[model samples]
Target: MACTLLRRLACLALLALAGCTHSDFRPDYPRVASTVLPVPADAPLAAYATRVTAGHGSDSGLRLISDSNDALLARIALANRAVHSLDLQYYMFHSDATGGLLAQRLLAAADRGVRVRLLLDDLHVAGKDKLLRVLDGHRNIEIRLFNPFLERNASMWGMGKQFAGDFSRLNRRMHNKAMIADGAMAVVGGRNIGDEYFDASEGVNFRDLDVLTVGPVVAQIGQMFDRYWNSEQSYPIGAFHHDTPGPEKLEELRKDMDAHARQFSQGSYAHSLVARVGDLAHEVPGTEWAWGPTTYLADDPDKSNPQADSAGLNMAPQIRAWMDGAQHRLTLISPYFVPGPKGVAYLQGMRERGVAVDVLTNSLASTDAGNVYVAYASYRVALLKSGVQLFELKPDAGRGRHGSHFFGSSSGGNSLHAKAIVVDEEHAFVGSMNLDPRSVHLNTEDGVIVDSHALAQALLAIFADATKPNHAYQVLLDDKDRVYWQGKEPGQPMVRYDTAPQTSWWRRFKVNAGGLLPIESLL
Candidate 1:
């Protein structure tokens, strides 16, 4: 009891100190306005997109990218094929191998005279200023940070202090992710620019999803990008950094990035990715593309403003409408599944109406965010009682794949990072928005909703494979209402775990402890 009091006192002291600290940074810079570059008539990507989406009227061509290597390769391929412009917006862009490789590709594209606009959320850019400045130094490349911190070089504690001082502003984030090439084709999904997201991580890799699209949808996505790009929240890197890096510095960084890319290419994973390059043509062939009516859904950039009336700017209502309109079945795949009271009530209502709802989310062992799992766990019994079928991805789910899953076969751990919903196996929604309060209210998110039976079935097929006993645990309740996990491995016997399977006591303790806190809404 004394220890608890001491810790509380310490926290209070820290908060007091944070309250005393004032931000020295301001957003009073000359904001230069720019929009998405128009695609030239003879642009290669424009020609390809036009040829593929011809005679379809306003319908868009869509292809799902379930494999991690292919997702990275597709972005690189898009960059390579881009003739006019490349617009990239992401929540996080790491400086790891996959990020460096993509950065190298973007640099090469910029050298080819393609205008590159890279907009990233500022939450994760603390130690990446030099690299971002160097990228911004490029003649044809520009970078912006959204909802950035006032303190540029803040340490962990400093960041905490800043957040404590300005909780309302710092709490909000931009969670959108997209890559539009030549204003013709775009890759929009849950992935950011990172090795783990691309299945290149040696540790935990994300099992995510993305869709490559062309036609009218790309134009809509470009408009969405423009909305955020020119918003008051997005500030150019030059706004913070007055002194630009010299050409010599840029050349040095270029050589370093190129060397890193060369080294990364020498690896066996790179070879495998390169070997499958030809497979992309088969996947994205004009005839094979799924033609559909697609809607681009995004939250307004003003959602981040503390005083802004942003309720009408949310995408949650549209998503809820999609789910509410489900007549027969609904399948949801979210890594961080924290469905609060309203969500639970809504799902229960759907089940009451005889809708078959299946949800695939991260298990305690496989989840990166334990607090989210705890919050989600609170509703599991309620969800199960309401006839909502639940499945949790196993930590080793990626082991079965030879070299295809988002995380490589050799990865020590794997986690589900895909956020998707299929309604009645006829409509599909894929994007960065998760079914959590943070995504619904706190963060700015975007995605594509395609009214295509084929696309819905394709996404469902991926979900079906992932929910197999070997890859995931089918959650169930006993006669006594106690929850248990049912799972089976390939050629192995079925087993049941009364507690969270494959998890440590320490991990479980942390989750339980986290639940005692009043932070479920924040999860």
Candidate 2:
């Protein structure tokens, strides 16, 4: 199968180079025997299920995973302790160190007779079909992809073909990320399975946030997983390949994974896992928990379709409810923020009602997505003029932490990737939903709205530290309604930049040039 896929990819590449293409490029991949199993209620995690639910009524016991090490450790701990099933979903899951280690753990769990389910977005799954098929050969493990490309072998060229032949279907993607263990505990937020998400990447560290919850709310998360798993958009790994690994090859794959795990055992990540083994019992029932009701909000799987009638069930409407009901203040943190006219008007209306609106997003220098940044830049003036406080993240914001060797350090750069909102510091929202139109109207998003002021205050504190002058640039409108970035270094004089602070000349030119393009809606 791998050889076959390589041949097809070569053919597609040749065709692409030759400017020869087919209009009917729809892929009719093979399907394998599969079944969507029910989430079991009884598991080892049920022992502490009461602990996480105790005294909180219907609210879940939540802990903020702000540190990358703790975030990775928490997932490892849950995977190790899960006795019944593991349902993992994400938009991006790299085949790097962290992702490989997680796969090793999942394989070990399956060996222990635990059911493992992995669902990932198809956009990033190109060139990984063989690895997925090998994993899917395991009896207890199943791998599926959401809105996958039929041409799985040709990563870039396949995407290009789809873009031209089927733009409407290819444009929408699944951006949700979550990991569930034993149907009792789950982690949901902006972090995907990759080195960058865990601050282990070499070039850039994403300052992200997630919530670890174990309670009744986890059931809803499990249900959300099941819905997407059963949706038509999801396809089993076998659906992409006609051949499956036999027993001998499957054994070889397992041995390879085992060797990889043994190699990782000598690393710091493995040491963290060793220290936190069996710690899930102690992690819950905390006195720090704020007792109140909570709501798990998610968009229907059909929300990916522009014409899908998701109606009030979409995350945008639910999030808007929180934004609309804010009586005093709102703090929004999205890495890719492109507030169109409607968003600007919403914030302005809140300001007119005497509400404070503060926003934090990636700056041009710190942004990894320049096209999205251009769209966001077009709205900065409007947002500022309407009394919206704006702050752009500093590329070097996490340097202190990197130097201290505390938080996970990326290669010499950092950017904000947390998607959260604190409304009046009374209610908090944390999840995969960004404030961009892609998240609001196209991608399926999931988040938990906690009716707890403590959580809100914690998120607010993160926002406060992140918005410091050294970590972020405060955007202000001059008397002439011109834009300028104001920032102050530690124990240094205040400085201002007429252009984006610390941006290169070419980046500035591209941003200015991109602003002229009518791409805000697609951003």
Candidate 3:
């Protein structure tokens, strides 16, 4: 009898514990039917890059940059003007000056009835006060959050509450950074909205790149935003305050974020880009920009191959395939590179086939995601021994300054944020895809595969700046197998070293350490 009573008591306690929690994906909202974005039937993925071109960088229409300060500001300004209907999406839109200021410009544009759509990842919005309310209320503005975790009022659930609750599911992140305006011009590539991206970071800013285009391509990107906007993946802010009722004052509060577009000096970063945009659009040569025709290739769960939806046309496989079959030299610039065994074997085979392969990634010191660093490190030896030319960004890139793009310095303006590949002086791939497992298995990212001689030549010019002696660390293992870095100048002797903390050895340890954890695919 005593044992029975004690067992019953323990069972009751367990039931009580289970009753107290709720699921991360709440049920307050209706169970919306899932649907993937339907790709336009008229435009297939094979239309783009059907033809090829080279030596087009001399056309004088391309703008290139190796730094993030005034140059970036120019690009941003042009980006802002390019948008007649702006769709800005990013993971981190900080509340700092850079974010605040960009918000101001965007809000100002919305006020002009330009039809602005802002989709921010919900991680930072959970407890951010007045900010969300004000933005949500904008007249012509629509803001949505992706994959939100809402806490229940304990008002509902039928045994579904028995599951452990999770409010912070950090594994799934929306890492796409794109801006589209006017339906004809789009800026797509690697950039998040923050001080770091805008060069407002006095100590450092991301060494990032974005391409501005005025073509049918912008319409394709616009369709992508429409899918995410209407998907079950995104939720509106009005739904967050369910029973408490959304306040009517959200409208008046919305006007406050638009206080600074005019404050930017005429020649400042934001202003000049706006001026150049007119020129860029005017210079759009309508006579066959692509060798054949252009098509937008995007990821969708429904149409993917293998499972027809599992990996969804990942850029890694696409880029890897391109590298595997390339006839000449292939250069890689992926800040977060993680080539598993197969990726290694594939690259090795390519090298053995006589394709000159070179790679540029953040030195262990400069990476912010240490966990990813470790995953990448596991393949480091495989890459070096494969006879593939391996190079890491020096701690100090951009003219020997600690805060330059030569190294992926978090404090120095240059972080190896470019996700690009140049092949044999013939073609190039630029977009938001980073070469990593997490990016491969998860996340919905987009980028354009341009096979234009002009575009490829333009990309090559930028690559020239990125690989200069002062900006990049040429990884030289020398015949003795001793690891050394060559940079600082053209004729400088190589400096021997094991690893670096100048970028942060701690971060590398953390990344490699994270490799020990069981949920690597989750990372």
Q: What is the C-alpha RMSD of each candidate to the true structure, in Å?
A: 2.6, 6.2, 7.7
Q: What is candidate 1's lDDT per residue for 461-510, written digit by digit as tens?
A: 88888888988999999999999999998899999999999998898998
The lDDT of each candidate is 0.88, 0.79, 0.59
Error of 2 at 359 (Å): 0.6
> lDDT by residue for model 2 over 29-69, one digit each (tens)?
55443433444445557667755576666667777777776
Q: Indicate the worst ten consecutive residues by lDDT in candidate 2.
A: 401-410
User: Per-residue lDDT tens digits of candidate 3, residues 427-456?
Assistant: 666666787766676666776665556666
Estimate the TM-score of every prediction: 0.95, 0.90, 0.75
Q: Is candidate 1 or candidate 2 better by TM-score?
A: 1
Model 3 global lDDT (CA atoms, 0 to 1): 0.59
Per-residue lDDT of 328 in model 3: 78
- In terms of TM-score, which candidate is strongest? 1
TM value for model 3 = 0.75
**What's the residue-level lDDT of 268 in candidate 3?**
54
Full candidate order by TM-score, most accurate first: 1, 2, 3
